[model samples]
Target: MKKQFFCAAAAALAMISAAPAQAQPQTQDDPYQWLENIEGEKALDWVRAQNARSQEALEADPRFAPMYEEALSVLTSKARLALGSIHNGYVYNFWQDDEHVRGVWRRASVESYRAGAPEWETLVDVDALAEEEDRNWVWGGVDCLSPDYTHCMVELSDGGSDAAFWREFDSSDKAFVEGGFYIPEGKSSVAWLGPDTLLVGADTGEGSLTTSGYPRTVRRLARDAALDEAPVLYEGEETDVAVAAAVEQDNGGAHVFVVRSPSFFESEYYYARSEDDALGDLEKLPLPMNADFEGVLGGRAIFLLREEWTYDGETYESGAVIAYGLAGAEAQTVMTPAANQSVEDVEIGKSGLVISYLEDVSGKAARFTPRKKGGWKRKEIGLPDNGVIEIISAGGGTDDAMLSFESLTRPEALYYAPARGKLKKIAETPAFYDATGVVVEQRFATSADGTKVPYFIMGLDSVLKQGNAPTVQYGYGGFLIPILPVYYEDPARPQHGALAGLMWVKRGGVLVLSNIRGGGEYGPKWHQAALKENRQRAFDDFIAISEDLIETGVTSPEKLGAIGRSNGGLLMGAMLTQRPDLYAAIDCGVPLFDMKRYNKLLAGASWMGEYGDPDIPEEWAYISKYSPYQNLKAGEPYPKVLFYTSTKDDRVHPGHARKAAAKMDGLGYDFFYYENIEGGHGGTANQDQLAYRTALEYAYFARMLMPRSE
Candidate 1:
């Protein structure tokens, strides 16, 4: 259910937990600042040399080849469900495999897709385009005109970077329109206002982007007109995160929205009556700054509250879903979470809202339809309970959805559910590894502050009874993301227990997914519990889980390993420096280590709403205590960590890993380091690259935690 009207703050905040980094000024205290030079030969030389060394060491292991093959096989398996969404009477899908490593944009009729056998028509072959143009192009996404959906804007990223080039595409003809609407790359956003017009937010020139490196100004670009000369609809402050535009064209007309995000969580929304409206024609919507724009439904704009707000003299509590009429009516309540409930994924379908939520750390889903009489009519979509549920594909002009259900040990089942219709099991992935003896269970660990932190532990029942087993705990406790016990995650680039099952668990290692504070497992309150100064609570929660594992005789400190990326990578750093004795190895991938300078690097400034600004002395007082780089001590019993990042990770600075590794090297600590030359924040561009990295990770874990014979 990805629409132009996603939570602006959450989208920006994702860069912290879901992306990578680079770019910063050199300081006297930072000796490894040269690594921040994204394309500098000197920096690249160091990265290349380190990659060679780490790859040799990890790939030399006997288990590496088989693991790589298995990962590749699973990633490229055709039996895997083709997750797609209905668009213009068809279901569109972006596919990648061993053949189409760069991926292909394909679509099939809705009937064929629902029948579980889509005769895909290739719209754009990225692998062919990359070869023909001699460019490292990655498929970004496409924004199309509503209804017809023939005219579209195709986004193409260079080597999987966030910044991308948008070109006019004609889906009807399946070709790029010559000299059609084009927006140059630079953390941009766009939507079709009409057949000949687009509402765009992009880096036009100097001062066009916010301090966070996102477009602060949005303009209306006419077909065949110069992007620079387009009419500026609105301008936000330089300090603001960014400004974005979305168009909702329906029976009424084209309703334009410009969301001006001043911070990660605060925003001001402006609206236009029609696509022809000018800058002055835009009217500001009276809404709370902390309120998030979900999407428009039945002439009303949907919102989710992150804080209590008395709107129109009525109070709406945090975590409440509300809707406001476009004709300027009082805000009405949509859905209020129950005592044990918190919403997770929200997708706006053509006629309904598909909400996948959590109840006491478990998954549930329902479709909310706007009733003519008033209030939202909720219809629960029945699926397997007590497992991870993901809305694979929804919206895109259809009430039908692609849903996935899986537990830690169970293979994922893909279902096609129609609006108020029965759930049809269209596809299911075969078990990657034998899970005959494997079992998954929910457990709670008491944190330092006496909060019950939920976590999922999966392994062989016999192994649990044996009392001690090598274990890997994976966590990402920030950005409202709940780490569910799915056998895998993201069909586009699947990883998790799915690969770990084949590579680690099957080889006698345990897997754990921690739902600590700073995540959405228990909703907003759970996340707020670990904000800024309280960030250590997340680390404490993770530490408590490790202690519980050892106390319960599950595994020992010498057999434990912690793995996380991005913000979770920061968590790993905290674990490495703060509680090194608890784990045998730490996989800190594309992590933010230099907390003091994080805001000054890449897109880190946008995340100030999450981790407070380090320049603020008061904030530094709380941050410095756990800031990994500044806190790194020479004699600390830090684990031999495996630090990895991408050379072009434009979200979190690669220098974070490079600097920390260099500092550790200076301290005479022996550790492994690797950097992918082509991957971006995700650290891998294609299935093969993903397979290679997956194999490397499992091999490292195998060597560090598994038994010698394995």
Candidate 2:
């Protein structure tokens, strides 16, 4: 569904696509097909060779070492905000730094955390565990049992991959339970249903994985039983994306459910109950497939409507928040987003529901409580406007919630939105770079289809006025993710604004964050508009912004550098083959270039809902037009792109970048390629790795886009 995949017949587009794939060990018309052999010694040799060359090219630059150090300092800074999740009376936080590279599960009392001086207590040291076990263990997540908040399930992945193993841990003793609840690695989802019971979805060899490489069935595991002997709660088709059991707890009771997802945006919910160490038949919830189950509060099943639905003579529009009685009664409306607004996040609390939204790209939040008579009561939570609002924690056994606000020029600040009274400022992240004289401006660009695309430009006033200033355009147009103007979100990716501001803007460079289609900037409609065949609209939107910057004299083609990773990496590929003349440099990371073979790769088939099945001829026609690898030309003065991927990346297969680089080399094009031997889909596992990658990225831009020193 996101960061997107499909399989198909070999057609004329196949011929065009196969041309570049032809390299040394060409198999079945794909020359670089051997690259897909992930851990194969031969494939790794090529990756190592590329990494060496790229490291030599970037690390030798004078700006690289200093940029690396600065990034590491900010990443490991103690001044950064410690975001916490409320559970019982504790505020828990997961922290990773220079010392705890693998991170630590720690917590502090709610009182201490709110006082702005937290007394930390480490429950589990992941770094120490990894050292003791002699394994590359990454902290996946830890979910403690409700009510007591003592017994917990800890998930740990290898090299930060999606597949992870689960282990039972005792928080009070600060140690894992000896030989307690252990589920081996797979694309698994497991949770605590009770103190001695667990609801699980994982692999046990044959038929455990769906076509999408996820759990095809949900099972209930006892504390003493082997996973294979666990009772099957529900089973879904192999074609389905996944089937997993979910547990929603509140003041009323725990609401257990089995959600079967046929596609990314569609889910079928079945309510379940357990008694005497056994499960009762699941009762399918009478709700539209498109309705997303938000959470349960006050014995009501809350939902976010993605499409219109009429229940019991009452009609609710799409994007409306509604709730139905778990004991069976008429559904009631919660809140509806306006034409210009899009619901960004919804969190259920002990006292009310907290909804954060974007109105014309401005962030706001409101708390809602259902009335006993009919409708609902709404109270807007007072917070700074015109910035990014993230609901960090809401309904984890407490009415008090944790939230953060930030903007392009503003450092992120954490706040405690208590059950009553004003929002209290807990802490603020120190400025990563000098923001003095920096200006953040939003401008609209006209796309080819007459649609207005929004984008934010941040830079020093002098740089904004300077003609043909060195500029970097960053974007990710797929996935319903709205790329807010923040310092950074995922610390794993370099495209986020933090490193760009620290390494680029201060050196007289301009940075642009474009809000293009195929994203949830304006909600689901914005994303649907650019799905499948309409995918070109997303590319056009990004291009329009690039053109606007050039036409407005903020930057020219020679001084422009573009960066995007994952889905945005696909966008970079489009920019590469579609309009290479528009930029001077491209940093393409872990991208999907070979669209024809994408679905056959890991987890790619699951995204057929977003990107149509390429196996079908009609779908291939539109896709072949913009498929980046197939679109590459012999000579177009294309920018020297730096292609980077990770050998341990299990989500977006490393083959995508590997095959593309091999093709580029065969075409006699100038480029840089780097493949990290470790790391997962994020391309980096820890702050140290992220800092190094960040340095390599900014250094590449400096060499390609920056002007010569006097």
Candidate 3:
């Protein structure tokens, strides 16, 4: 069995509460008509008292002392993010090539900054723009853009169906090529060979199945003398396993390099020039260890090899990134965060590396550039005094690009800068809601374990903190994604603002965000405190926070409510089963309930690296102990919870949520369930649909947590 070795007594006691009594309801004059009911007041009082009890537990628990230290780090180090480009200059400005917001392409230029030098700009947003007719059948769009940006290659569906067609986008003429080649879709992608010629790697039915599933073939495309020319670069070794193809150079004419990795431990690269077939040297990135190679990124192929043995006697943080350089070279460790710290996003350019990582130091974000020799140019991008800095995109020249910026009181803004200097504002989105009257404060509460948890107190602060205000709290405790303030303030636009629950807030409800563990709040160490077998620690911490809030007289569980999505949904599920007496209502959306089979589902397997593979006996033993679906017993009273999932969710199988509801219903549990039939991962497809979904959530929260008859 693996353990973190370092243990604090306070942390352990905070993991379970010995006292959890419902608090007395606090009365208020003119406490919004919507929250005038006894049910609302009771719920509010319940959570408030729970929160207080949790605080007392922390004071008495020495094992949980570490949690408070970590929470303080998170609160003090939240980075204030800024946006910029750092590669070539012309492409740094944000541009939209696709009409669909998600599909829109941004091209910003990056240029080097010298003393008294003129700034340079380059083409960045060279992307496929979808015409009205382009969105007809397939979920496809433009392929590659010509070197001079005069011609664009479009990948259309076969017969306007699921199959794809390859056509050229000639900007000079503003029309597609007269005729096009049929490029079958698989793990295939297109690379430009010339202004008019393309290198497309595709697989047909016999080669790669055109249907919506997995396993496909690989090939390269080129221009043919006749309109109907077959594209056959090379046939890959036949196997059921779908290997990912990596393209090294994006803009080049001398030679094109293609790297193929069947697994993280092994890889093969083939290089060719001008449609000529002379496969170059095959490079293998071998790690003398048992590791799972994810996929390829940048010009190098990536692998996450788990060291079977612990490093310095610690098994919690043991994965490393091995980057295999093309052209038969040694695999270099391009980047590595603190042990156990999860890497969020990595942007590598000619300059170095800008990695967006979960807490590694002080629980805030840090930027590091690889020194030309052997080490790294690391610095804390000091946005912490205001808020957390999230690096959206970086690359244009050697030291610049546009970055998306935001803070507690600021909406997202695009900051234009040349390098490690001053940032000038370029653009910002219009706020659909007014937050002029709302105030958001960052506060830390000591948990039962003495671990401090950071939470955002948002609402009308003029009201006393001890008032019986209706409150809605949100939290997510899975994966390492952080919850930073969105600088979201809009009172008028209830649907778009934090006031999504404003129906309750407008009715005097306070909205709160708990930065629970199992998140990258205070770096990797903070998250490791509540992982796998220790997963219950996250739940304990959350319950403790709720207890503290109630004890502080913010709102009791009766008028208090909880909401979470995805893993947060799983958090809610756990809360409902483990401590249903503490919460009045819970909104669990797209959650994984069946812990026994979570790994068998779509996208669930990938999470095994994070959540641990339940199939494994050692890991399963711990997972089973807290598995929500298995732990739900018959005849136990549960909270009024609403479970939501999407039928079209291609990721975590909707079955987890669907079956949980069915089982709960059959077992006679009281809950609400709604499953959308469209929209893949998200329960809803578009913005309009999102508004409706949010409206329903607010309505449900208002009805249960802010009843109108106290």
**How high is each candidate's TM-score?**
0.95, 0.95, 0.65
**lDDT value for candidate 3?**
0.50
Better of 1 and 3 by TM-score: 1
Per-residue lDDT of candidate 3, residues 1-710 (tens digit): 01100110001000100011012132242122121121245533532443344234333433223323322222222121212333333342222211332222233323332221224332221223334445422233554342245555554332111224455655446565566544433234555555545555454445442111222334444554432244455444443222333333333433454434332222344544443333454334334344434333334444443342243333322344455544454355644556435555555444555555444212234455555675456664443344444555554224453445454445555555445676565556443234556677777778767888877766666543546676777887655555655553211122223333233443466877778888756544566678777788888888987887788888887877888877787888888888887778788887877777665454344355446668789999988787887887788768767776665444445566665665676678756666554544456543334444455566566567765464
Ranked by lDDT, the better of candidates 1 and 3 is: 1
Q: Write the per-residue lDDT of candidate 1 for residues 1-710, one digit (tens) a residue.
A: 22221111113222221222333446898888777777789988988888889999999988889989989988887766677777778988888877888899999998887787789999999999999999999877887887787998888878876667888899989999987887765577888777888888887888788878778888888878888888888899999887888787656477788988888767888987683543347788888887777778767788887778787779988887888898866688878888578877777788888888889878898888888887788988899988888887777677888888987677788889987568999878788788888888889999999988888888888898897799999887887767777776653223366777777777778988899998878777888889998999999999999999999999999899999888888999999999999999899888989999888777788888888989999999999999999988788888889998887677877889998998899888988998988777778788898888888888888889875574
**How does residue 381 of candidate 3 score in lDDT?**
47
Better of 2 and 3 by TM-score: 2
**Rank order (by lDDT, best first):** 1, 2, 3
TM-score of 1: 0.95
Clash pairs, candidate 1, are 20-651, 20-652, 21-651, 21-652, 21-653, 22-653, 487-498
Residue ranges of candidate 1 with Cα displaced over 4 Å: 1-25, 275-280, 491-495, 707-710
lDDT of 2: 0.81
